[model samples]
Target: MVRTAAAVWCSASAVVLAFAAIHLNPTRSEPAAASANGNHAAVKTLQHRASQPHDADQQLNDVYRSHTCGAVAKANAESAVGQPGSIPCIGDQVKVAGWLEFKRLVGDNVFLSIRDIHGSVQVVFRQEDFVGFTEVRALIDKLPKQSVVSISGIVTARPQTAVTEASAVEIAASSLVVLNRATLVPFDHQQTNVSEELRQQHRYYDLRNPKLQHSLQVRSKVTQVIRSVLADEGFLEVETPTLFKRTPEGAREFLVPTRTPGQFFALPQSPQQYKQMLMVAGVDKYFQFARCYRDEDLRADRQPEFTQLDMEMSFIRPIDIQNVIEKIVARAWLEVHGMKLELPFRRMPYQEAMEQYGIDKPDTRFGMKLQNLQACKELLSQASVARGFRVQVPESLRSPFKKALPRLIKELALRNAVTKPFNGLPAALEDATLAQLDLVGADFVCIATGDHAESVLQRLGKLRLAVAAELERLGHPLRNPNEFHFLWVEDFPLFTESDTAQAADGTMALEATHHPFTAPHPNDAHLVFTDPRKVRGLHYDIVVNGWELGGGSIRIHDSDMQERLIREVLGADITKFSHLLKALRTGAPPHGGIALGFDRMMAILLSARSLREVIAFPKAFSGRDLTCEAPSAISDKDLADYGLKLIAQPDTKL
Candidate 1:
């Protein structure tokens, strides 16, 4: 069983001959086959000599693997490699490459699991067959997990009682070449509970996790489906500049300094203006997988830089844009998830959504719909509307009120409330209200009241989400995670009270609800000059399972309205948007568009808790790139080149 170097060469020669006959030429005369085999073997010998590591360096760059682990597994399944008296159709001599995921030595057999992007396979190296089994096993043991290796072996049926976690068919390895040895990883890639900081810091290792791998794969598939659907809809894929001018929509923008003093190029928050300009340029329909940046506080769904599925169209109404978007979404869902979405998604006006669900992006999967307590004559006299929602306390909690009440109060910011047994209901509540809400077993009532019904409902909306979360924690979930609820929330007010700007009279200003470019609703157009607050915009938001997937609006092609909204209502500098205003004046067609948050969409589709799970290299919660450690400090000389200087150091360490 102890083979020498000469014996190893002979065995290698035999493998080369077998590979040539099985793969190079399956049908040949005996003499021709023998001659061809000899030539191939000689070539293989020369390759081996050329690939030999010089001195102590173990790197080999010439090993060409012919098969993937996925292909090997497929071959096994299709050819019935594990069935009795069955032979696989794949050639016996196979060369495959991947990272070493696992390894074990049992008796004379060495079992090693190799994983590539497509899949993983098990390779069994035996002392009887491998000349330097001891040496190879020692090297494999010394190498770190995830070390890159190329294995040359014969594909064979796994033993009936092998009891392995590998593919049905396994490889009997003749030789193993260490392509690249990895260092000790910070944490095991198989671990599920690794800290987010560590994961983000070591994203390369994080990507090795199967969950992330699958998420990335699904992301790619979703993108492909979207592209295909958009292309089929006659939409041209366009690319807009990421380096854009400073035109504030709402969010803070990341500024890139120029060599000129006090001059900067701001990263685009979206491709809104560019796409509109494209519409003016006579590009009837356009779409982009646009890269957008926002200098804003981080959240589970927000990233500093993200991809947006931006689209625009000319000479179209709101319904036309909605129909096209619906088609793309329906096709994407059907192709990627094999789920047929109901045609023409349900639409809810902004007023109706706020009145009923307390939020524009309502999760229709569950019914904790807010109640109008002001419906009662008694409560109506006190406030504009008494917004309340009831949640059933699970029986699992022995002290339900003691555990849930404190959290609910803090979350909802509820200052006024009454806690009593179901039998001791408040006198203000009507019997019909109780019956309609189905509050028989419910032990908790969260209510918010104010003179402004909108204000009250906004607070109660937070309570609704908080209550649902509390119920889930208490072992009773009102919402189904598996459900898909698509809704179009429309009829938003054209202008809202601005939080930042002020009027010339020192009073609060009005701002565009969606954007200044959004046109007023046709019926409400006359109110724009009379009562702008009452005028509604021709805007529509696509909501799914409590998330605002995307939104769009019919844009104003007339420069007068655009300029008025920017200069008068919004109190914004008209000079900043002169380009857009000029484009609008140049016979621009009435257009509309939508931009879907690609990261948020993927996260919801894959059931990921945070956008980070779907993103390849996401920043930490503080908008810091943990992988590259970005938002780094600039050297004084580099800053001088940009004609900038740091006036003061940060209050906290980065």
Candidate 2:
């Protein structure tokens, strides 16, 4: 009857069957619960492989390591011999397994260096202690570098004069077993001159390098810290859908077609709408390490697909969101850099950041604030000097600054550079310019003419960064690289003028500076309908050094406000975002969220030159996955399954 009952349970769901079987059969359950008991004799033998010395010295064995290479080194360093409550040290037998890194022959002794994922250690084989030393030495000589082997040995203290970084102690080998052998590798692990193409092709080997290993380890530690901090703050980790409908949020998206004719699903550029919906679902605090996609041109800081530290909250102002993000960032820095970051970072309005530094994301670590010279035209007779800035470059940087001046002037659509002391300028114009700016003997000024006030400031901002870069290259950095300057840049203009686009009345069209979801500032709310360009969005960006760490805004939860901004103000297609509007109408709360660029964050932490260094598998500049050679051709039959056909070849130039 019991057997029949168990068989019946097995016919149901496997999970249900397993539960039932465990309850019904004590014989089966006991062994599964514990490693060893009266029912299992093999446990004793399995335990013997870890610490006990083998009876025969020359005999090969299949059993592997009892401790890691790192662990072995740590054990010996704790005490001279062996200490109570610590791992085995001198004169104790142990087993270890790893790939061979190198081999050396000295008289009648053979020395081998082995390394695993954790660390490396040295193994020594002596003729006096081994019965078949000559044969083993010959075999070791024939083995290739990076061959996998397991060796049982007795631990011994390394000679004081002979010890190096590989290990502080040496292992006296009892016996060895060959597990596998590797072929000759393409390039040395640390070879800097290796071509990137070849290294990418053999990325598995490339990842074995110590620098990459350390980078991955740090990445894991930082991610763990973020998870712990968010979890402690009462945030629930959630996974949102990636296959979503196409909507005009920002960048281009990757489209996935279905068998249903003309029906398609687009990969989400972000988890924006879903996270907002999570707020409506009563998940008050939510977060995810989301994988996002963007079908756009790539750069050093960007990839076709990347990870984002996405999060959202309900019943929060812009400051509330900023505070939470600052906590997360501080915790992450503490874990990596072992320093406490100051709380309540400095805040600067977008207008001030642009006016003083010439860029929205300003690196406040250095000084060289831009000065608006609009007052100069009032002192001069020239009427066309509509907008200008008095740029003062240091005398020490005059040569490099001069070299970068011509290119900067051409890019900004500005006029010539003016050296101090009024070389060829008329006395009146020179006096007007000098009077507007406080200039020392080492400072020179450049005044842009006819450009808009905003354009002039932005161009000067570029010049600010350029000067900083040149200063650093010339062995006189403006500020220390290690110093982190955290700032909150907020109160940005809601809209920007489009270059080639026009509105319905043929006037200049406007685009959202951040996104359409951002609510206008309380003081500027009325301006949205009248003069939208003058309205300020309640958006905030967290910047560090010169990089925009992340951004978020207090979103407009009211359906009416959202629709007006998207349809009437920005002139976007209403139908594409109707679903979001419907969700908003279903009694959503006042909510806000942020998505931090995880790749860029990692690159910043590691001080890596490219985002590809931090990513496990990143696309090349040409958007090609060199490892697998992806984005390959699909067969016609496979295309038919999706109810689609290739229209033309992919553009090689793209």
After superposing candidate 1 on the true structure, give the runs of residues whose Cα lies further than 4 Å from its correct spot: 1-63, 77-91, 162-166, 375-381, 393-402, 415-423, 428-443, 505-507, 650-652
lDDT of 1 by residue, 136-242 (tens): 55655676788777776677778778635545688776556555667657888777788889888889987877788888888899889888888888999989998
State the displacement of the C-alpha of residue 71, model 1, in Å, after optimal TM-score superposition: 1.9
lDDT score of residue 591 within candidate 1: 90
What pairs collide in candidate 1?
none
Listed per model in order, the count of residue pairs whose N, CA or C atoms clash below 3 Å is 0, 0
Estimate candidate 2's alpha-carbon lDDT, on a 0 to 1 scale. 0.73
Task: List candidate 2 stretches off by more than 4 Å.
Answer: 1-63, 77-88, 105-109, 127-135, 165-167, 377-436, 441-450, 650-654
lDDT of 2 by residue, 579-640 (tens): 88999999999999888998888888888889888887788888888889877778899999
Instruction: Summing lDDT over every window of 10 consecutive residues in candidate 2, give the lowest-scoring window.
Output: 1-10
